[model samples]
Target: MKRIAIIGAGASGLTAACYASGDGRHVLLFEKQKKIGRKLLVTGNGRCNISNRNIIAGHYHGHNSRFVDAVFSRFSLQDTITFFEELGVPFIEEDEGRLYPASLQASTITKVFQYELKKRNVDLQLHRRIERIEYEETGFTLYTAGAEEHRVDSVILAAGSCAFPPAGASNIGYDLARSLGHRVYEPWPVILPVTIPLKSLHQLQGIKWDAAIRVEVNGKEQERSVGELLFTAYGISGPVSLNVSRSVNAAVIAGKSPVVIIDLYPSMSGDDLARRLDRLWSDGGKKTGFSLLGIMKERMPEVLCGIAGVDPEKRVASLTPADKEKIAGTMKNLILEPGKPRGFQEAVAAAGGVDVDEIDPATMESKLVRNLYITGELLDVDGDSGGYNLQFAWSTGAIAGMAQ
Candidate 1:
């Protein structure tokens, strides 16, 4: 039987090992971490968002998204659900098509992969970091950091991208791809917090609420996301911010200015908000500005009053129509200047990696090297903050696993 060597026991590496081993091939899965799935365990805050119900094309970003479409078509979101179910792991669908294990534990997903690997007779190696990878006429030889050598008929570089070092993420994937004559784009942080200079944001620290945000590059709106926004001491985090961070990073990489405009009241238009303020003034006579807008957090009214140039000490009934309009506009549009993306340690994933132009989308094999396959974040493809990234891992891994 031909031997297959898969580097990195991540979600993609684990999936590739299962498929390649099941095909009557001897599979060796190597991991640098002490245990498998260190990153996976922390995914979705330990709940493990396995996949998403809506795994469409628009959710993914890359130089050539057609590659993702082709790979995902082969193994879809439903296929992923069914595959997990067959492993005796049930799941539940949460908001925005996010899927979590029924046990609400990420360890469950890792355990299922472990059981499958054991049953398939795949050899699992841990704490073995490949230091040198050399391709020969026959096959490939991988030398680990400990000076151990491994030879296999095929090599699948699923080592993942360098984003979260604490989780054992490394740059080995980029090194290996470049060694094999493939172009790799500089990696950038994605799905991470955005640093802002607004000192007022400090007042809203630890506050969590829903909002709609649009990313603007050089005064041009690039993308928008809507979800819960969490204010932090450094900047903003949460679903909406994380979703649009990729665009912000791209703008920065291109030397362009990126800013985020947030709609605090996404559900209400400017006119509706103004009408609501007018009604509040009529209902609550002789109330301070802060007291009139006390429906939200007390700090929020003060911040809004400052942004709209309204006096917190002024009575709501004493406000003119123009003051009400200004307040309404401030609530509808909160502009913020963004700094650089959070460091790789805080990023959920990286935006750029092995260029897809040198990769075959149908088979996921490196076009520049024979029997050299690539998968997961090692590729340029990145998805939104939901379960899309994990789904991409599974799909690409499966295709490479079944490669002839």
Candidate 2:
């Protein structure tokens, strides 16, 4: 049997091990962490959202997205469900296509991968930090920080990106790709919190609410997502912010100024909101501005009052027609300036990895070197929040393992 070396036993590396070993090939996996899946343990805050019921490779960003499309077509969402079900990990899909194991435990997801590795008798090495790889005429030699060397017939670079540094993410894979005559794309942070302007910081702190937010750059709509909006000491966070961040980054890198519009009431249209506000004002003419907004977003009536251009001291009967129009506009369009994003150290995942041009997307094999394949975040493809990132890892790993 041919021998294969897989580095970094995160979601991708371990999946590759399970697949390559299943082919009756000797698979050796090296994990830098003391235990594998440290990052997976914190994914979905430990719920371990494996893969979404909706898997769209178009959501992924890369120099050549066609490569991602081809790979995902092979190991699609249905394949992921069937594969996990075969391992006794039944999944339940939440709203918006997010999928989690029925047990709702990340440990369960990791355990199944570990079980597969054990069943295949794949060599799983923990606390093993790979230092470098020297490509030979026939194979490659791996040097590790452990003062050891191993020669293997094929190598799959599955080391993830620099996100979740606490999870033992390292740069060994990037260095290997660069050193081995491949063009590595400069990695950027994605799926991160958006830094707020001073006005937003002063006006909106310690605020938490569910709202639909859309990011626009240079008058072009970039991304739109609706979820809980969390106000931090520094900026805005939560699912909406994180989901829109990729577009924000894409624009910022392209030299476009970014803006965010928060639809505090996505369910209500301008005309509908105007009618509702008029009804409320007619019913509560004697109430104060703060007292009138209790009908909508009870969590922050005072803030909503400011957004609606209602004077705090003014009674509802004192409002003008123009005031109602202002209220409707502001309710639908609460403008915010989204400044630079936080670094990759805080992102859910990073964009830009080993250049897709340097690797054959079909087999994920390095185009510049023999018996070398690449997978996981080390590749240039990243997806939207919903479990699409993990699915990319799985599909790419499967393709790499099959080629090996």
lDDT for 112 (candidate 2): 81
Count: clashes, candidate 2: 0
Residue 299 of model 1, lDDT score: 79
lDDT of 2 by residue, 1-404 (tens): 78899998888888788778865688899988888888899888799878887676567888887887788777777877787889899898897889999999999988888888888999988888889888889888999997799989999988899886877876778998888888888888888888876452545666777889998876878779998888777778888888998887777788888888889778888788778777677744465456555555443555555756677567767777787677668778978776776887788898888888877878888888888888989988888988889988988888887776
Clashes of 1: 0
TM-score of each: 0.95, 0.93
- Residue 69 error, candidate 2, Å: 2.0
Which residue window of length 10 is worst by lDDT in model 2? 292-301
Question: Judged by lDDT against the true structure, how good is candidate 2?
Answer: 0.81
- Please, what's the RMSD in Å of model 2? 2.2
- What is the C-alpha lDDT profile of model 1 across 1-404, one tens digit per residue? 89899999999999888888866688999998889988999999889988888899999988888888888888888888888888998889899989999998999988888889899999999999988789987999999999999889999999998988889998988998888888998888899899987887778889898999999877889999899999889888998899988888788778888888999889987777777766677754554455655456767887777778888678777877787777778778888888766789999999889999888878889888899999999999989988899999998898888884
Give the per-residue Cα lDDT of candidate 2 at 358.
75
